[model samples]
Target: MTEMATIMDCPPPGWEPLVEELARRVSPATVIHCHEPLAKRTTLRVGGPAEVYVEPASEADLAEVVKFVAERAVDLFVLGRGSNLLVRDGGIRGVVICLAHPSFSMVEITGERMRCGAGAKLKLVAVEAKRAGLSGVEFLEGIPGSVGGALRMNAGAMGAWSFAVVESVRIMDYAGRIHERPVAEVPVEYRACPLLKNHIALGAVFKCNATTREEVAQRMNSFSVKRWDSQPAAPSAGCSFKNPATIPAGRLVQELGLKGHRVGGAMVSLEHGNFIVNDGCATAKDVLDLMTLIQARAKTERGIELHPEVEIVGVD
Candidate 1:
């Protein structure tokens, strides 16, 4: 089949055309995998295929791809490590852009300030911070997502959150224009951020403080131990629900005697009441059903509404 025909035939509006246009404008080496498996890319090991999944070789290449999609009004989803996401079984509609390649993962440390790309893993960031004698990011060692994902979700643990250490963030709008803004510009609260709908985070600079390497490492280890005792790191998203300010969500679930609640193949982790696990042979419907049940039970029984921590994507 001709390349253009393969990319264009029966694809979503503007999706195939944009792909073909990108193939012409960008170098062949810069674009990888016109179509890729979503299940393999996500930590959950669930989800259907994506029509076009591009791994841009460099920042310029990534920008170009974003611009093309923006101009054409094509649907696009930016993914970074895919740790706290639940992709539906029917698959995504348009393009899924992944920024996990080394070109998007460069890191720099200078005294109390650290600059890292959006694709850098939070765990790796913690380790690097320790080597650089930085302390604020030590709590990030237990986070399982990328820097971009962390910023998007305002991921927090051990009394520290990504936004708390963030001095400024580099962002790229759909038009490919890059801009930097201080943390105050982005409203953050309870694992939520008011990031622009069309802007994707490129990287961030964090104003951390100097500390002894031994001290930072020690804190990271202690935080890890604490997390292991509280969360089910076996195979699940870090937390399933946002803790209400008045009380912890896990504690509430436990109080309701719903620690091991199950719906189909999906079950709330016995280890942590807030986490829902696939157990084995779980379907997307099973997960959705279980979440619905939990939310209902929490409201009807406890007079509290539990908010989901994980982002649900794709069609049912």
Candidate 2:
């Protein structure tokens, strides 16, 4: 078989033509894997395959894929480091684009400023900033996703939100148009960035005050210790429920005696009530079922409705 054939072969059912066309459209350096299993891509380690998975070589290459998907009107999902996400059992129907290329993971620091690419892991950003003696980003050390995902969700950890450190973000809209916006002009809430709801976050520029490297390291270490003590070590999509303003989600779960609840191989972590962990052999269905039980129990028994904090994607 030809090299191209290997990359484009055996697409799930009707996905072959689309994958073939997409492979032809993007640059040769761009990686396209048809019928790629997504379980390995996600932190939860559950879910089926993506009909087409793409890793673009550059921003131009990513624009090509986005343009193609927009023209085709097929569903498009952008994958970061795949934390805080759950892909359903039947898999994603259309194309899933991952910004895993080196072009999208670069992190550079100049004095007290840091510029990060979308695919750069949150942990890496913190480490780099810490190395540069920047203090504000130490909170990001405990977040488990990529900068793009963090921007999208306004992800918070240790009382600091992603946008709090961001001076501006470079975004690519679904129409394949790229633009940069300052944080003051962008709208963000507790856990949502409205500007990124339909657009892609390519990267951001972070402005932080100068601090001693020793201080940054000390802060990161304290946050890490607290996270390890509070959160579970098992494979999970992070927090499963958004804390209602009236109370913290974990506290509510604990109060409701739902911390150790299990359904199939999916269990609410005894370590953190807000997390649902896969018991090695758990399926996406198991996780979803357990999540539903938690929500229902929270609503019926406690008079509070729990909503998912993790992004649930793809078909059931």
Candidate 3:
């Protein structure tokens, strides 16, 4: 994680009251700042700032903060590691809760099942599962997001998805009530978990098959090599578009001659047509414009509608 600079003492205008009230209600859990720049929080390293940034110490504290924000009718966004997200220049309006606290990042294994916190990185979860001699999540080793983000998006790689191994998920509602639902109960589809769109995932339980640790590690290493070979080395939010039913998004973009295309500091990655990389000074608008160009060209030339896989949030 990149170190954040010193936080400003003064809150952003019009958010002073909200910040003060939040500080009182959500004590112990640090309320970092108002108008905190979001670039460092995301993998792409682009984006403006968050209205009110918060880091809850524990699940209970997170719940309290959520309930407080909900009752006051403030818009809330639960940010994970920001691997597959793009926050616009105008920034997020209300509270931005980040589940980076240690309490929300615990990982445990028991009897062929592993439980991981929402804040736990996908790579860490994969390593933990391998340590326990579990298989089936080797694909997660290459994904660049947190477990919660992965679950929310039904994140997949190398023919494996989050829901395929999910046994159950612990989620917290807008009112701060927690519930456990089986995988069957959650409406998980390709690249989406609609049930978790509004609620926040706390942790997930995955059922894995018993396997040799060496075998799991080998599979994981294979996946890592494949990802490194295909994906860009520059900062990016992974694939910009989801693969349509008929064709892979990357292949389609390549066919459309969109590879190496640039809009401002954002460019279509030469290594992978599906990725839009930040060449140090890219902004959210640049990425969005590049996406629009790709979508337009694909639709006009190939009659294929390209849909973004990366979540676009905040005002523009």
lDDT at residue 125 of model 3 (Cα atoms): 91
Best candidate according to TM-score: 2
Clash totals for all candidate models: 0, 0, 0
For each candidate in turn, the TM-score is: 0.91, 0.96, 0.95
| Poorly placed runs, candidate 2 (over 4 Å) | 1-8
lDDT per residue (tens digit) for residues 89-126 in model 2: 88887889999988999999888889999999999999
Residue pairs in collision within model 3: none
Q: What do the candidate models score in CA lDDT, each in turn?
A: 0.79, 0.89, 0.89
The alpha-carbon deviation from the true structure for residue 139 of candidate 2, after best TM-score superposition, in angstroms, is 0.8
Tens digits of per-residue lDDT, candidate 3, 171-232, equal 99998999999988998889899988799999999999999999999999988999999999
* Pick by TM-score: 1 or 2, better one: 2
Off by over 4 Å in 1: 1-18
After best superposition, candidate 2 residue 71: deviation in angstroms? Answer: 1.0
TM-score of 1: 0.91
